[model samples]
Target: MEIRWLEAFVVVAEELHFGRAAQRLHVAQSPLSQTIRRLEASIGADLFERNTRSVSLTPAGRALLPKAYRVIQDLALATDAARTASGAVHGTVRIGFSGAFNHLTLPVLARSIRRELPEIDLQLVSRVRTGDGVAKLRNGTLDLAFVGLPLVADDIDSRLIARTRLGAVVPIDHPLADAPSLVARQLADDDFLSMPVDGSSAMTEALLRCCIAAGFRPRITQEVTDPYIMLTLVAAGLGVTIAAEDLASIMPRGARWIPLDDAPLFMLHGIGWMADEQSSALRAVLRLSEAILPTPPD
Candidate 1:
């Protein structure tokens, strides 16, 4: 069957309304209906159960959904591969970066890529949480991603590019800010701003694990999805927070960053991608990452 037929079918399945699906596909309803009918005839089964008021996927359509998605996704990847083989390097490369990476490293990376690989277009997507970065990367949406160390997935391959220490970010005038260095036990009783319990923020979990290793489960006063917002709250004196050293570069006003005493220094940072296939843009970015960021001493 034609790819367009499957595309039209999937759109109808998702929208469940011919007019709505047609509009979403930027086509008229009559042609969309014709396409669906043609697809059904080819498959020898009706795909949608429709009436005057509603549209629903039939059994055949339900079964075809996953395969259709896979076929479309594979076809897109193939197209990108073709573009790469042609030496065009002209398609969009969606990159996922954390807030800290965006603030400190992206400018340099973007400038270098534009200068050297002017033919390859770049799209920057900032994920407030690292899990979002991983998810986007796995789903083929992101060509490459900047993530911290301790990415435990076996399906991902990464190279460590830089290292940053963990620190406590507090209000400038907060009592703990003046200490020589912050320790997990010293701030055990302090209300903290932490990441969601769902484990979306790797750095936050690293900090929490640090606290647990010191014999306490932090009394988190608030949980935020975005680490940047968590730091903002810390700056406002709402609560204390643990963040990477690079985070200080994007500190909101009134914040103080104190190095963690004997902290379990996080893996500084890494460029990651699916282990099975590496795209040209991803490899180029990885090489550039190696050049720009220092490799930690062995």
Candidate 2:
């Protein structure tokens, strides 16, 4: 089938609604529907199940989604490679990073890449969470990513870059903020803010375990995805949070980071990429990253 057919199919699978998908593709709804029908005919299976109320992917469509993402991204990478071969730029590398704790590593890596590999065009995507970054790597969208660790994907390879102990962030005026460190039980009654349990990072899981092990289930008042926002909420006295100790460096004016000494939970960070990645520019970045990024203390 034509690439446009695959493109249309992917968009429809994502949106599930024909009208929204057509709007995204800037095409007439009728033609978009026709394209989906043509793709289904070529594949000999229905990709979507639709009715008056809603649209949903069929089993076949669900199976095709990841493959379609990889195919599209790979083709784009190939086009970039071909352009570079024709003297466009030496190569282009797309790097995804979660900015929550990489405030130091990301900037250092970017500057090093620019200075040492001047011919390579570096594209940095920021604030990408660990789960999203891993998906992008698997689908060939990101050449490299800084991810939260304990990553267990066979198709991906990663190296541990940093690890920091998990701690609590509380309002500056809170009663416990003056403590040098605290055990989990000390804050059991406090209203907590946390990352959503579903698809949460390893750090969040550890935080929950820490609280439970301390003999009280945490009263999580809010679930958040961004560390900065979590800290902001803490500063606003909405709730306290458990986050990597490194976040203390960027804690907002009204927030105070207190070390959680009990159980000594830690958050691991790593740089990850697809196992079969072959881009020379990406490999170069990997090499430079190994030399520059910090590793957990031995």
Candidate 3:
């Protein structure tokens, strides 16, 4: 029932390994294991199933995870509120953003924060994938995040900031490079370079959905994490890729972006924060965003 026990439980659940969880918590494995045992006894349920080689969460562990995250986050916010009341600490806001914001949105937002909210400490974490961003927001590790839209988390609040058509990136001399636009099926047989298929990437998920809707799964030749690198590889003739059409402005010289004729296949970008967030710093940033960020096109 103690906070430390819940912290240990959450860390162990995330790592699924006592050794790694202990290392992360800077505690001995024996103590970490004892903590989890104490937590389970208090809750009257077994939280994990462990064997010699593997550790997996039990049903009780899965059920407790999200609630534990909220408890820890709420405590942290209460502490922050108390400190802010006394002016002991100016607010610190941690913001996570994907690579898509690097070229413009992030820089502009940073400058605006520096000029308008000089007392606030702005921590910018770059290259945060959409899924990871959402997770961080829920756990209170991030105050806000720029993420792919149509986000369905009940605990998160999001607003659309931009929308852009998804398109194909190809080598300049590739057969379809000169086409004005293309249907998703046109690239079915081509070697496709894509973002990693782990559920963390919104772009990768969009690409798969688009290909499947087009009647064939894309032949993925390589999985790249960075969009710039994905385009660079495409420019080298390694393979073609599906990406936001706006990226064409920053793409390498040897690559061309071809728009997708599939109207529904587009990327929606948004800023998201926990629905129950009570941080004044977060509210300030959201207010500034409304004035500084562009509205999505209809």
Candidate 4:
């Protein structure tokens, strides 16, 4: 069967209105109706039950609906893959990173990807907010990113490549600085610096939930969007901030990194990509992510 006929049938099956489907398909109503009739004849099945009032799919049409949709989706994916294979992958793949990434790990991953996927160029971008990865992915801008959970974007697919212990970063001279391990409750009366509460920022949500799970709302004294600035605040003794243990390696001096004992031990960090589009660069980076990720703590 001609792909156009299947396309026309799928459109009408989804819309259930000849006129509206025709408009959506940017074709005349009469031609669309004719296409559907021709398609039904070719398949030897009446795909739609249409009366003067409305239209509905027959059993055969309903069964064909899902399969037809898959055909189109798979075709699109194959076409894209062909394009990628033809050296069309020579475009910059924009990547976003959450502020919570280990300072060393992020750069190391980027360098490895550049070495492996030379045809695909990469640009490192920073995002202050989170969970907007799906929107960027859908629009064809962001190829992949490293972000913290819980990411609420169902449209984008993520793999939990690594889990790092959560820790408190505080000034070295702070009262709790000497403590080898930190508990969420120990910081109850301490001034805290956190990310915003808006759902757009995934790391913010993670931090808020961490505080709540500890039994008391944090005495949040300042809200900043920049991770570097938040770390600076901790260094300046303005407030303490929580971070992943892997980040401790690159942290500036004069700050103490204390592991959280009773609190959720680890934060999930994942490599995310557009679920619908496959990228050669992304596949390479994802492989590197899996290789570099430190094993989860016991």
Best-to-worst ranking by TM-score = 2, 1, 3, 4
Model 1, range 81-112, lDDT digits (tens) per residue? 88889877655667788665457777788888
- In candidate 2, stretches whose alpha carbon ends up further than 4 angstroms from where it belongs are 15-38, 44-46, 49-55, 73-92, 114-127, 212-216, 294-296
Q: Arrange candidates, best lDDT first.
A: 3, 2, 1, 4
The predictions' CA RMSDs to the true structure, in order, are 4.2, 3.6, 4.4, 10.3
Best by lDDT: 3
Residue-wise lDDT of candidate 4 within 207-261, one digit each (tens)?
6667778887888789887777777778888988777777687667778788888
**Residue 129 in model 1: shift from native, Å?**
2.6
- Pick the TM-score winner: 2
Whole-model lDDT, model 1: 0.78
Stronger candidate by TM-score (1 vs 2): 2
lDDT of each: 0.78, 0.83, 0.85, 0.74
Name the runs in model 4 displaced over 4 angstroms: 1-89, 99-102, 287-298
TM-score (all chains, Cα) for each model = 0.78, 0.78, 0.74, 0.66
If both were scored by lDDT, which would come out higher, candidate 1 or candidate 3? 3
lDDT of 1 at 285: 67
TM-score of model number 3: 0.74
